[model samples]
Target: MNKILIIVFFLSAQLVYAQENLNFGRQKEIISPQTNTDGTFTFRLKAPNAKKVEIQGDFLIAKGTGPAVEQMKLGADSIWAFTSQVLPSELYSYSFIVDGLKIRDPNNVYLIRDVSSVVNVFLAGAGKADLYMVNDVPHGTVAKRWYESAGLKVNRRLTVYTPPGYESSKANYPVLYLLHGVGGDEEAWMQLGRASQILDNLIASGKAKPMIVVMTNGHTSNTAAPGESSKGLYKPIMMTPDVFNGDMETYFKEIIAFTEKNYRVGRNKADRAIAGLSMGGFHSLWISANYPNTFGYVGLFSPAVLPPSNAASPIYKDLDLKLEAQKKNGFKLYWIAIGKTDFLYKNVSDYRKKLDAMNFKYEYRESEGGHTWSNWRDYLSAFAPMLFK
Candidate 1:
């Protein structure tokens, strides 16, 4: 009888201990990101049985070249945790590699998709980075608008950002044609670039004029971004050939015509601006050169102006004639920026030399890091304020 009583007492005590240790309700809090007052961050993942876990993120190092993997430590409650060092004020994306598979943070709900992959996102600080954040400012509206592309013979989509009070006001606003990189589409600026937030905050602060920002899909053959249309069911093709074939120019004209017809925007060159990053930068170059008098303001963020493989290529064939025309037309701002360590640094430098030789008046700005979105976002923040001023 005494043995039975002892066994019962032991089992009850074990049950009570297990219940106390189990994270029944506090699991969410335990695994969620905890921002410390000192500007560091603690990320936790609840994977008890995982043999190995590591955190990889853009913020892990400079140059934004990461999968800067850092091993996570296992805690008492089987939660793996990693604390980041004092990070700078910016938005960051991170994911966990459990065993060998890459996975996003289940605790984090804020995510941004790039190309076809999605990752968890978090903001590290305030103040300078607040432009990228959703502040208590009058926000703009971003809409996915479809238009018939006469050039491609397909219905195309683009993202448009209308400033606050635009719905109620009958004001005719200036337009800014924003372009994305090779793998990006209309949604790139809206999602990754935080175009709406940046424009909203800048306009609220009186830094940037209230203007309509149009983000277009640079892909010539595709109507919209991947998975954004029924056409996306077909295999994606390379846009490089189409770009060189002058299909983009036709697409550009179609988009411009559509914008003029649909939106209450200025018609003249003085009220127009165009800017892009990487391949979009290349598009901006070709587009601005092709229609020299169309845009008053031009910005190229880490433009991919590759050295000509042969003189027969369209990108290099035009030579100085296009730039000369642009110079004659007169531009309000020809802003160009690139990271010092970017892979295309040499290409941009060589192009700048050509510009210098031609006396092509341009504002050059160099930033830190490589071919990454951080510099691209910074470029937009700086470039937007300069427009229509």
Candidate 2:
């Protein structure tokens, strides 16, 4: 009788312990970043001991003062909350500032890593941001690929996205060589820019034709992105030893060779496109100019138009001559886009002036925001639809 009573008591105690330790009911009660009916979002943070709380995100205008931070109102329930005005349809990232330290919202699970910083993310309305969401449309395949680079003397890694029905169909598709910025790696476009999602959505909507996207890591100093190579778990840096020295543009042929040999893609010039953001834009400009007729379509999204201060490399030599040659060589498109407030706006404008002087025909697009993933994603959406047409 005593043993039975002891076993019952022990079981009851274990049950109570499990409920206390593992029960998340209280935490689940806190719903944050609630997308209200009117297209606004209400962010909530449960901070009982925090004396001050604020919300900072891309949704608010920075106005050159860094991120726009808004104060949150604390209620009697010890929860701090802030309701934003009606936001446009876009994917936005934000963090909570509890008393001074910036932190992610505990309630939001969606996060994206931009270089070394990680932040929580949420979608606003249902317009432009619909491309960023993984809708019920036919999806594509994103794979990590490694190619031998004889110039760099290492096996470099890249990301490739094959459009939907690629595996089942024997049809050859056009190729788009997508490049990333200085601090980004092969994964940057897929993660922050939502390249695959955007492509899937666009192709489904018939706005863009089926194509293959090869996302290359432009930082040649390392063989791959941080922690994905011999360099183990090292923190990412903005500058690389081989960057801005024309090495990437010089050795870019290996990437094209690898993609052509392995993937079922068209080899014609018109079937090839190259485009990138920021530093990648600089690379695309030079690569297409140096190897004329290789890529019929070229896109420079907020490119760093200035040449390297020390242009001793032969690849950087006779750039104006190369531009003249590229102009003479017939191509389908040379598209340039930039945000009005981007730091590179002046540089791009100056480059446009140079192009005007040479009477080069190119299309230009101007957006509203500065250098950001939002603009880059939007650029990809607009640029992809015009290719191979």
TM-score of every candidate relative to the true structure: 0.90, 0.93
Which runs of model 2 end up more than 4 angstroms from their true locations? 1-24
- The deviation in Å at residue 266 for candidate 2 is 0.8
Candidate with maximal TM-score: 2
- Error in Å for residue 235 of model 2: 1.1
**Which 10 successive residues of model 2 have the least lDDT summed?**
20-29
Compose the digit string of candidate 2's lDDT tens values, residues 1-389.
69999999999999998897666666447888998898889999989999999999988866676779899999867889999999999998999999999999988999988778889999875799988999999999999999999998899999999999999999999999999987799999999899999999999999999999999999888888888999899888888787777889899999989998998999999999999999999999999988987989999998887677786667777778888988898799999999999999999999999999999899999999889888999999999999999
Q: Pick out the ten consecutive residues of candidate 1 with the lowest summed lDDT.
A: 307-316
Whole-model lDDT per candidate? 0.86, 0.91
